[model samples]
Target: MSTSTAEGRLLRYVDALQEAFAQEMARDESVFLFGLDVDDHKSIQGSTRGLLQEFGPERVFTTPLSEDAMTGMAIGAAMAGMRPIHVHIRMDFLLLCMNQLVNIAAKAHSMYGGSVKVPLVVRSMVGKSWGQGAQHSQALHSLFMHIPGLKIVAPSNAHDAKGCMIAAIRDDNPVLVMEHRLLYGTEAYVPEAPFEVRPGRARVVGPGDDITVVAISNMVPECLRARDLVAEVGISAEVIDPVWLQPLDIDSLLASARRTRRLLVADNAWLPCGASAEIIAAVLERAGPDAGIMVRRIGFAPVTCPPSPPLEAAFYPNPGTVASAIHAMVRPAAPAWQPDPERTRLSYQSSFCGPF
Candidate 1:
């Protein structure tokens, strides 16, 4: 944690996200909002709150529930040099707009050899917490991360949420800003003034000695808690919260991995070809072949993520899960922590498979 003092207001995670959007809109005229319920009483959560009131309908526009049409419209608007911020209610909802995004928005630059810029940011939430079922509960950001020409932004705290989001709004490429449904209520500190959160920057959340634990999405705070647990036992686990998932902050990650000499990455995306695996590869390439890495990613069980709450509790990654992973990472030799047979997307091909 390089931060000696916290800045901005201590507000909820949702407020930090909103503060980013509000500040960006205030700072740049090119930044504008368009989504399903900017004006409707039934908005997708409350992240879009007060924007319609402040910017007026001209700048803050609403669309019908058609994700495809709105996405296509945003792409065209972006090609015309107007920045558009589109919010889909959930990651699943984005499937409806893939044609516009993948075929047009994502391909426009390379398809034309840098002829045009798509300064569009599509915002969506991973709302798996509300028993929203498989459809709504999926952590689908990995799907976007797979696509080229699209940047992925996932912030774990109030400060990065504000900074990273402002960066996304200003970028020329199409970017995806994913917020977890479970994250909206949690609180963190955020600055009031509009500022810059440069893309591809990651934030280290805790200072530790034994190991460096890099966790993405909402798993960040869990990593912090895991650090606390290890500290109780005299092991220090440095925690890093990535503000930008794609165009990742490899420099920050390498610095921390070098300092700690051992790296553990935690993520909610699947294991075979997820964000965690990609980052583990980066660490090894930067830190050398002899670097010690224990990578752990938590996701739904392939048992279709059984709908039971107790089942979810047992299956999903939590503070306890992270604590156990870190403890094993620092252990001389672990015979206890067996590979979880029930988790999603863990494949032999991806484990420790990197450019190192």
Candidate 2:
């Protein structure tokens, strides 16, 4: 489970997350993982596979389906000097524990005047799945961003998935790690040893000069593909992934927007008053009216996600949609155009097999 080589091997996103949990749990005795179906054969889409056998029931176990009660238990355990990682299979269900999360876990340290620490990590999955529909496919991380004392991160790749998981476990505050379901099958080179992707930092995934495309969570890969498509038309797009959402790296976003003067934010959720809107507002406020930075955003079409595959495909933003938006902003006078339908189809529509 450890490697000393300088060049780490490629690992799937799910395996990378499992490694993070295994390493951290071994490093500290207090680190433990608990969630519904964690001990089941499926192991939460195989991310928790082998944890039960390796860590035993005491450290890795399953819980009842009561999110509120389980979340409360985790908060209490964190206050009692143990680091707990609570996994919610879907972000949609987190709403059931808002009181425990917003009122207690997020406010404990401040309410206790810094004497108490809530070292807890809540891992949840977002994004569309096979006909999961509105109830199970919602990405509500933005709701938690408004609360104080909570750190939020949505790692889009395997590397950040592992690094951010380690960082969240080590952090002294309550942290929410939002994982995109489709990204679980993605692969990236990752180190065996534990590392931290510090919060409040943004990575420029694709560097360019013509325009800046700030993509969040699952949207990062789509925007990257859009960048490639736009390149055919002589457009260079600079894509940034704000790994940490609560303490967003607005400075990086502002710098890029200032350079390109045309920015588009693609998020995993709706745009109105969500992360995309927040990011666009931050950039505009700093850039000022004289900066002449034109901004736009794309996300779920401001409606409940449809259960049907075709409707779901239309609801979410794809590379074709993203590229079209970017093209429209950068070339307002150009004729209407879009990427090929085959290329624009939902990337995960065919690959993702899910019952969760």
Candidate 3:
């Protein structure tokens, strides 16, 4: 076992994920990981690197290209006193196993009257990666959020990524840890020891009183940058990252919205019936329409993701767009303005070189 480096050190998001898996498997023998290409040379973009060798084929083997069967296997393993981490290379593929996940794994505990425990972790990545197009780049977290028994989390940074992964593994119910591919390269300070970030908690990225910006997954960093950009124009934007999507931290969001009297939800997916809509609905329902909070949502354009770089650029939201939206909501009477594109070029587009 590795000693705890509680002082912490900077680790990339991918490294943090790998560390979490490594530590957890070492700590609990029953905890095993398996997924499509999980033991391959790429190792799910290096997140599963060194895991197969350390744990051997029995615990860290790869599955066939069958999502449904593999998911069933994971559920069966979980029910029989084992913690299984099933990795889906792309969240898009998870759709093929919806029945196993939503119908069986999700409902087994309640259906069996608490006698059966399905402690499972499904790790999947979302977002555009080298023009993967609509088929591969979709963020379908909202679909799982609609389900009753599953817990969904989309961690934005290395620290939260590691903590959330650990938490999901230890959770008794089935948990989905959605990772935005673009975040894998990002780095943050993480402790060497295992740690769990309690779910249903929201982290305030930037503090302000003017407006509340609730960003999901990859949008967290973009919104943080947007916060700084809006500051130049004298608009104080409070940015909040809802780390867990299922059990949303509505109280934190409502408190922030109540303070600012304005709320902007920026999600990685589309606006209609999405996480953003759910959040806005929750705040409005809880705070009441009498709260008089101004709300707006920004996400993917209402169309399928495009493969071309130019179309892809238009499809996704960036710091410039977020800042412009914030400006419109806070200073509606002011002249229309947006940050210079040259200065605010999307960082993920430039850094991501992927075929995974």
Candidate 4:
């Protein structure tokens, strides 16, 4: 059900993640939660609030300060018959456990010819500001995207967050769900019960003519705002939200591009060869040069996101930038105004060429 108000509920993304984990744990005894201070509940962003109380310590067990040890433990636990959900406060921290994710969990199914499966869920945070800086603020989903046997999920609103989170827990393959650092308080109308949001499918939020904008995660909200801003200037643009990044919804992209004949990509990733590059390239391959499609990506500038407010203001692409870009893309000529017949009679002779 949709809310009547203009603004949606403000449920934090961490809250959404915690609810998904708890729902799955209660649904299936095979599910278990693991991470640092998961038992603490209120200390870290209050994401794990009341989880330990319901599931108790066994399911919501805490880990020592060892990424390698716990990562290996999670992989072994998954292999030995336990669905362990590993939580990282920040995604950049996962790099220390890359070997376990890429080598063991990712390669195990293929190495053994599908004899085993690693149904593990790894949830991490990607913070750009809030003083987290380069170490903690990096949106490094591309790193996991490089690995073959990984299911990458990044949901924009509360509904997709819940749906994708439940889907990740049920997935037989390794799933990495990245929670945008800034979207913590963002919320939408999520189904009351657990739902499955199939991977590789994109959701078309708004339908329009002329242009199709492919947005990812938080980019979805930005696109919506941009759509409204551009509409004021008389250009209608469709917005597509790709919930799943890896098994991307190329079909939706192609369909929208073919329909609109123009594409504007908005993503959190940096320009050049990020996910935007791949999406744009796919359109070119399918439609060719005469497809009448032109793609301009809105994302973080080439420079890094410094903690400084001014630098970040310029670096991050907001709705204003998207709106401005849309205006430039569709620069309509102003309508010609006519004067009263009596007043225009004199001008008829002189107005032939006013400049002359």
Clashing pairs in 4: 12-184, 13-184, 127-137
TM-score of each: 0.87, 0.96, 0.97, 0.86
**Rank ordering of all candidates by TM-score, starting from the highest:** 3, 2, 1, 4
RMSD of each: 7.2, 2.9, 3.0, 11.6
Model 3 regions lying over 4 Å from their true place:
1-7
Model 1 worst lDDT window (10 residues):
347-356
Distance from true location, Cα of 146 in model 2, Å:
0.8
Model 2 C-alpha lDDT per residue in residues 180-261, reported as the tens digit of each score? 8889989888998899888998988888998999999999889999999999989999999999998899998999899999
Per-residue lDDT of candidate 4, residues 275-326 (tens digit): 7887888877888767777777878888866767667667777777776666
Stretches > 4 Å off in candidate 4: 1-12, 332-356
Q: Candidate 3: deviation at residue 317, Å?
A: 0.9
CA lDDT, every prediction? 0.74, 0.90, 0.92, 0.75
Model 2: lDDT of residue 343: 74
In terms of lDDT, which candidate is strongest? 3
Ranking of models by lDDT? 3, 2, 4, 1
lDDT (Cα, tens digit) per residue for candidate 3, span 1-356: 11122458999999999999999999999999999899999999999999999999999998888899999999999999999999988889999989999999999999999999999999999968477898888899999999989999999989989999999999999999999888999988898889988788888878899999999999998999899888998999999988999888999999999999999999999989999999999999999969999999999999999989899989999999999999999999999889978756667658778565
